[model samples]
Target chain A: MSTRPLALLLLALACTLRPAEDHVRLDERVGRAETPDTLVLEEDGLAAIREATPRGARLWAASPVLHLRLRTAGGPFELVVRNTLRDATLTLDDGTVIEREPGGLPTEARFVLDLPAGVERTARLAPPDADAAGSFHVAVLSDVQDAIGEVQDIYERMRADPSLRFVVSTGDLTDSGTRAQLVRFQEELETLPIPLYSTVGNHEVPGPEAWHDLFGPFNAFFRFRGVAFSLVDSSTATVDPALRRERLRPWLEAHRDAPHLFLTHVPILDASGLRSGAFRSRNEAASLLQELADAEVDALFFGHVHSYYAYSLAGIESYIAGGGGAIEEELDGIGRHYLRVEVDGARGVLGVGLVRVD
Target chain B: MTRRHGRRAQVTAHLLLALVAAGLPAARVAAQAPRTDPSADAPAEPPPPEAEPPRCSRARRRAAPALALTAGLLLHGTGHLLACERRTGRRLLAAEGLGFGALVLGGGGIALTGASRKTVAPFATLAILGVGTFAASWLADLYGTLSGGANAGRPARAAPFELALGYRYVHDPQFAYGHGLHLAAEGWLHRTRLFGGAWLALDDDTQRATAGLSQRLLGARGRGDALDAEAALHGQRFGTDGFRTLGVDVLLRGRLELAHLGPTLAGSFVEAEVGLGLQGFGYDATGRGVREDWNGLLLGRVGWGVFLGPSGELVAYYDHRRDDLAGGLSVDSVASGVLGHFGLAGRGYIRDGRWGLAGELELGSALVVGLSVLHRGAAPREGGAR
Candidate 1:
């Protein structure tokens, strides 16, 4: 009947038009340019180019390292990079040194470069000692909702740790995830001496469309030193099937032989199933854990419950660090804190120690 | 199954059976209670005067259902006790105690084991059965107080055989499939029911199929009041996602006629099922060709329904499994992980009970709507009349 065909057509249209807002777009957007003057990101990392022109560009880098390509007109050009780790190094193609200007915000790294007109050059910006990779320390923090005013103290404490490379987060950088709240959270980050890479949390669902533009992406993968870090979005308590297939499978495969640390906004399975601060589907969670185990991931980190927990899931070391001044879990002596994880290129994860800020 | 697993399964099965059996005899007695006084046939001798049974006050009768909605919701039998159905009330309360015991033991086991794959299935099964029994007792208590012992012992019958073909629409932002063809067939063989169904996507390669057999454990076949033990095999392929799953589950399902509880509940029934399963997922992508994983599934369902005429019924249900196409609801809180989906479904005959229409709506992370045209064979001669 005519009705059946009409119904089929409507179904097709609905399926085609379903909102596909997920982290996969961020993966595809990197290393792509809309115009010749636009900066092109090359690595599987999280960064956003805020402004681009013929002579200069300003960018925000959430990941510790950025591999980019850009074209510039002849003469001196100013490249301002914000939200970068301390002691970042900028170099031209194949290690040509470019010094950063002094006396800027501790989290900002400003570079001035001179180049020939109409020439495109590759640029690599990273920590000075990133490649040495014997053993390094990184801090993990999350759940700063409602506590944005007090998060700076935790950052200050991390700044005091000279060995900490950068901070990684599971999400909940803001209480409401509004653009204004996100911007305010970013403003507070200016005081930190290190960069923070994060996935979005459930708090961000109210404004899901805004987070991609502000935080780079909900799901991203990057390699630092010798460790592979994959940040996935479980803010909705489930991963989009397309994301699981298109991005996660490949990321896990690519890092199968390396030391991989998986981070997400929600734990795949709550430890006791009492709090249920985990994925909506236990079957999906168990399947994912099996995959992680099969891939031999080194560790997993999550933040949602406002407390600290260290446990093993599917034989992988896991931790939940949500002590960023949110409503604290009552009765527990511990308060605001973060995790300091040490990993070695050859030896895998060495230790994860809890650093209390309150 | 291994020896240890078999032993655990036996233990879990015994626990569930004990909980269910606690209410079985009482239900049977209530069902078989005499509808008419046999003494009418006796010679008319001067009847000995007997003290009338204490009557429920009008105020107490009015308050019974309200109490069921409040205190009885948690205590499981307050309303029945208030209505002076002390024997049934005590049985319900005892059932609730056993249910809570199973819940504690199963939940404690899962917590202590960290939900380890080796021991999760039996523990989860026990827990689901516990929750189902607990809820059923509460519902029974409410029905007993509200129905007022009217229209006692009426039975509802189901068609002995049926075949259906239908169209299904699914809307999920996470996947690409939208349209599907639904096919199902079910028939009774003596005291057992055999059933199979499939959902094939028209716009994508997604396909799912399930086949099962259920044996009547108590009550008569084709009757509303029955207990069944079912074993089913399930398979699904998510072509858009390049993954497939295969699994098997064993469930104990029961449907109790509400008329046994009270008159207002006549022609209505309550159903509950609890089960456990294990599923294996395999990926079809290039790098994931060798990638496979397994998961333990805890399945539970509870429903309340009313019979339509002699061969049709409408039901509203809550399903606690997430592996189906409907999946679990997505929310910003942990409750998303703890709860599943709710659904409404109905079936009715139009052509002398040989042809019928069926429809369903399910609400979860996705929305699923389905409508079917069905044909049924002749009903069995015995047990076909209501």
Candidate 2:
């Protein structure tokens, strides 16, 4: 069959994106963007009451900060930090303590910020006594496709481990990428103690405008301590070589010298060697694997397989940890688990510990 | 891709450490250790040798006949009868060619009717005819091949026409009661065979016709019994019990003989079937389509078949289909697979959504207690050279 018409139809659909509305509903909270930089946080039509950051911390001056974009505007702004978080310490660039209200659920850390516009601002919320260096843990999860019923136990298990800094997933957040499904997943995620960062999966699908509003970007990269975590949106089950060369190459090049990890929804090369399981073309997979090899990436993480498999691809340590509450592959011995990867700032990946529900 | 079978990772790690400590060449050690290790959770066992395939005495005997069936398909449906009847082989080949030609012609018609739904029926009809003919020809060639077995002493006796009779009871929600006398026949077309059956209502006037064609492809020995491959096409018209349903399926399946499983399973075999085709409804007198509405369908079935000596065979299976064909008699309603129905109460027998469990026995080769059948492994060898 000729593919021209189908391609054109997809192209036409991609061109039309729904405009954003005034209010954005995030998990349980609904709020409007107060300014281009700040967001006002409220619940149940409650007055926007915020606590101030202790006098010592000179960073964010508000109680709890929804989001603080660095100096986007001249501000004698007030940051409203949510009181729900347990004993939390907020910090900014240059080692400045932004908020330290002790570990209490009720006390809000309202801080008054006097900042000049037009500079970069990067601050992170970490537990009060977390080590500034050495080993850190990242929980890897994926394929929670409406297996919402069984996922609560998974979250509870994760909550029991305080050492896991953040949860990262190679997405399948919903069975079908619908707004309601996405919201439901978020509601379930709220039970987790930390945030989860994810790249979309084929199940999440492309062309869902809510994808952008829910997740950050199609492709994203961020560094923690010295390790670069790069995510390329290979959600279509096939990674076109041109896309790999153009978009993914730059990120690989920039992070080549650092301890780097790659994450995507579909495995670039299925270790199973089943043509039915992997990408459409072997050449594409080969090209992407070659690129990862050249960059000397430390480890590759993938989901889609709905089973846990550990192997090496193009000399890089790769793991498929799709044990998140989805239907287990036939004869794969169903087990719900996530990979707890410990990364050292000076060294590369220390070890990957498979923590299971049992 | 080699399927490594143990704590290969731990072994490899130890090997590398030992080599490093002993100042041995890393390349040599690396070459000895396989790169592809099976899933870590997989049970460990010694890897098979890289020599000739392991086989049993029975498998060695059936190799010749299995090869002949393979040759038939490779020879465009002529090889099966080549060792038996030259004229039959030539006719089977001719039928195969005609069917293939019809399929291509239908494909061309579809191209001509591109974006024009008005002319699809003609092409659709041609395509259906092509597949039907293909199935008939293959079944014909297979029967000639089945009779050409190396174990001629134990081979099934050929009858010009075979008749079978049986009885069955079905507890379907749509039909309060369904049980009747089942009668079926197998008629030979030259060397090929076609099967047709009907279940007459003993109590109610709900009658249905079951028709199908099947052919063996090849086989190879596994352990003590043979593994085989078969291609089949079947259709059912369900006006029985006031359910007007018509469904046709085509499958290319593989099976293993009962003995290969264990000494106790000497007369039964297991099979897995994957099929995709079209199905729809509406039937009239003459047991053919009156007005049809077709939709693409996907299906999978895993079954167990037991040879009841000369009494034919009995097959029990669990089927999964993307469509709910039997008036939604089974509907799990979840937009998910097997695990999705979790937490739901009482998702019964034929999983309502896309899964069903059924069992039936064929009375001789002529009568069937159910619409489905699990092809048997006739050869001593299993399918493939493996």
Candidate 3:
């Protein structure tokens, strides 16, 4: 009779002590800005970040900071800044308050907004706007986590292909949702010669709100070659219902006929976008996939179980790109591989291939 | 649940922040030094970075090695139990010798597993492997017992093979002999831990035989026999170290045998053991042996030990046996010992798939030791940590 409580107490103590080794903290610097580099914006410095980008750059609306890889006639320098909704007027040291266009940047022959004198700012070209003429193809990689070497190899090979445009990641970039894991994921992504646009996956969202707050608008969308590339957050688990039928269904339907692909962290069914599984529940996943299928979506890409599975259900080709990440479960006989798509005017044909850097 | 999750999140965030902050000083130090390109070195270079020397106060550095030694010693108390059977002759000693050899070579596996920078993957693997080895050793013991003396030294021939080797020895003026070697292998068959092995022995007297069989049992703890032949009852008392076992071995064994015991002794023994325990000993029909005039032996088993793994535990057990001699002379010797075991094991994907490692230590008057590595399921070519 007395043993029960003692056992409970021991269990409680064990549980508390279990995670100590994992909680090792080596130092104390985070969130605090260091050094006044023209590239590194201190708090909410929109002008500095923009000054770092080209004159007419169309940026992600919710992006908090603009990362600039400064390239001069001499060499290259790197800069970064926190750009919020607030606008800022870029002025040279000689009082040149450059007349900047208000919204929707123009594409060709964009001016290089030189930094204030005495402040050596590195300049990098931002992604060209959708209005730019030529259509390009993005890899749309998803869920590339701990398998750093393999993912890096894939990135390098993709970089070598001139036909390939910038890369788009459909989130779940880490396995344990740890900062180190996220950082390593970012480090691997940084090796790409082209730019990368990413959306959050279920694994990326440590909590419903915390990670979203840290990485804003994790569930959002963008346009490439006038085609709608929606980064919809289909994860109903461990998150708030920012994805409502009234919000997503109509938007998806509106862009259904467009030459577009839906990029998400969950899979959708053919009938409805409602997730349902006894052992593994994707209640919202079912609804999303169903909606895509009903809409005749071209391609659906996602990852979760670290497997490579492709299903052509209801006229939609669904590909699981989880092989780029940790293989927690069996890879379902598909050794780690990546997808390279050729997107012309309309049809997007994906070719799965090996990344030979090992 | 929310609170727990919140706490977990908060703790994770704080810890991450702290790690980044701590790394800052080093980053700053690096910044201060020459900005050497990390990629300048080749990838195949044997360890890109040496383990940082303990850089603390003199007292701290001194304390670090002491702490490490203390931890090693503490873990040592839970070393491998290579011999868990009675010192039937000298088999237990030989098994211990092999176990020691494995320990020296085996510690490298633990070091390599521990040295991995990936946090979750390595420790998770270690914990799993440790737990698994602990379980495997126990299971092997049970399987060996169930299969009887016939299946003693052969390893299971299948995918994900696991192996164990043990030797024991005892020397006394009266007995003057005891030594045996045992080897067993296990593998996955329809998701069940199935195994087989062979055992060999050379005693001081001149009794030698080779036996082997295969068995399948619940993970590491099971009772019963492969085939039931005789039904007899017997009780016995056995003591070793600081323990004693008083129980009856209810056995029914009917088989053939061939032996040449020189001119004085040469014959076969067929018998069955039965009864409630050692206190209650009795005999029944179905009996034959070289010492026809004398009766059999009553036996009990007792052993205890501490395990070194996460589930490290102190286990003790007792058993008794009786054998009827054909001649007037009857010999009954009690055997007992303590065993301590430490282990590390886990399941994960290496080279992008599933793999696992298991290791254990057994120590006592009678000891047995084993180590096994396994990989199963399809592996993703890409590798990672979770």
Task: Give the per-residue lDDT digits (tens) of candidate 2, residues B1-386.
Answer: 21111233444455445434422322332244333333322212223322322433444334524644576554434543334344344444554555555555554454332202334344444444555445444544554345332211111222345555556553322233356766777644433446777666666656667677654333312211222232334344333322244556676555544232112223444455555555443323212342322333444444544444322344444443422212111111111111000010011112121222224532110122343222222221212222
Please give each candidate's TM-score: 0.64, 0.42, 0.34
lDDT string for model 2 (A8-101, tens) is 9644422211011101112113122344444333222112222222221212111112333334354665554442234455576667877643
Going through the candidates in the order shown, the clash numbers are: 1, 34, 107
| Residue-wise C-alpha lDDT for candidate 3, range B44-97, written one tens digit per residue | 111122223344244543343333234323222111111112221012122222
Give the per-residue Cα lDDT of candidate 2 at B229.
31
> Comparing 2 and 3 by lDDT, which wins?
2
CA deviation > 4 Å runs, candidate 2: A1-96, A100-132, A240-247, B1-386
Which of 1 and 3 is the better model by TM-score?
1
Q: What TM-score should be assigned to candidate 3?
A: 0.34
Tens digits of per-residue lDDT, candidate 1, B79-162, equal 877876665566567656656666766765654443444565567666766776677667777766776555233333556788
Model 1 ranges with Cα > 4 A deviation: A1-45, A53-56, A73-76, A150-153, A241-246, A269-296, A305-337, A353-358, B1-156, B159-310, B313-320, B331-339, B342-344, B354-386
Q: What is the TM-score of chain B alone in each candidate?
A: 0.73, 0.38, 0.24
Best by lDDT: 1
- Which parts of model 3 have CA positions greater than 4 angstroms off? A1-129, A132-135, A149-151, A207-210, A234-242, A269-279, A282-285, A328-333, A348-358, B1-386
- List per-prediction Cα lDDT, in the order shown: 0.72, 0.49, 0.34
Q: Residue B181 of candidate 2: its Cα lDDT?
A: 69
True contact recovery of candidate 2: 0.00
User: What's model 1's lDDT at B278?
Assistant: 70
